[model samples]
Target: MKSELYYNQDRKRRLFVDLWKEQTPFVDNENWTPPPLGSRFHFYVSSRQELKKTFGGWRTNETNYGFNNLSYDYGYYNSNPIPLQPNNDTFKFRLSSYNVNGVYGPIIIDMGTIETLNFAFFSGSGNINSGGVPSTPAFSINYYTP
Candidate 1:
């Protein structure tokens, strides 16, 4: 998923992302180790001064983290509380995960400084196909800046 920033002057910001699994079957069944279904999942956030920076000093928002199982029809939702400052203007936010796939967005914020937002997800080792017939999963992101 792409990292996004809020462009408002609000002091407090809330970031949220919804994720789910699509019932897509793995092509190479013989050589694939399916990821654990309905397993505990975690998320983290990273901040960067420049868009092209290699290391953006990643950090985990323990307050807004939770366990999610994407295989289910009802997707998982996670939110992080962010405090914005006037000095800390013009920064990018990146979203990452473990044992998760089919990510949707960074839900743009109406307030604060945000630019060059990117979306990403993990699809190898620990990502398993959903049980039963293939189906399309859902994912979304929302934020509160006030």
Candidate 2:
């Protein structure tokens, strides 16, 4: 396989924009959109919002919604999904791995070399079982690979 390692330092790039929460089960019909990719990126998720519906009415809380106010200490959340460019007018594999830290500039890579690229956000165990109200604190990513 022929490929370049580092990113392109010439083309200007844009980093992460904002963080968002992923609806559980991934089938709730709730979807999120992430910003474009560049060179450097970084995402930290601390807290999230949990929308609930009690007997009285409906409400939203930050107990363990699924990635609300992300922080660097708790863990790192991608915040956005990296989109891969098209190849010969056709979309190829997915690009994940670099966090919000790798979307600041053009990450020039040798085209038609690698098969695929993938990335994911990682959260530590510090806020996994805090036992708040939502029962779980998770960081999620919403993206389109086409």
Candidate 3:
């Protein structure tokens, strides 16, 4: 269910963009190979949409899933399914663990769970490191328009 935490059109600009800097590596360090789609997903932002932009060094496992907020917390929602990038293109970012260059995701977010923002290059398999080759960074100034 949606919440009262939304803003009207004119008020919508008051909403801010959400950006994550560090994310899980798209491939394993051993051989830099991407797993199949639906192999994994990541949850973003432990709290509501209260920051200008977030640099995620945190994990999905840390957030309490009981909380719920979209317009205010997660900062993103999709009516139609997000289109997956073609030709193995993905958003480039850094690895959370090593702080080195890492490429993964166009950052697919699932707003269905109102408790937290779910992120994964692929949709639902739980395998991990399944992102493709890098083309762009997920947050290039206007990643989200609020």
What lDDT score belongs to each candidate, Candidate 1 first? 0.25, 0.26, 0.25
Q: Number of the top candidate by TM-score?
A: 2
lDDT per residue for candidate 2 within 1-146, as digits (tens), equals 11111111331211111232322221224453642232222332222222334566645322311222322211222333344322332222222222222121222221122111232322222111111232332333333322
* Candidate number achieving the greatest lDDT relative to the actual structure: 2
Relative to the true structure, candidate 3 reaches a TM of 0.17
- Cα lDDT tens digits, model 3, 93-142, are 22222111222212233322212133323221111111111111122222
Candidate 1 per-residue lDDT over residues 55-140, each given as its tens digit = 45422222222222322111222222233222322223232332222322222211112121121222211111111111212333
TM-scores, one per candidate: 0.16, 0.22, 0.17
Question: After superposing candidate 1, which stretches have Cα over 4 Å from the reference?
Answer: 5-36, 51-140, 143-146
Q: What order do candidates take by TM-score, descending?
A: 2, 3, 1
RMSD of each: 21.3, 20.2, 17.9
- Candidate 1, residue 140: Cα displacement in angstroms equals 11
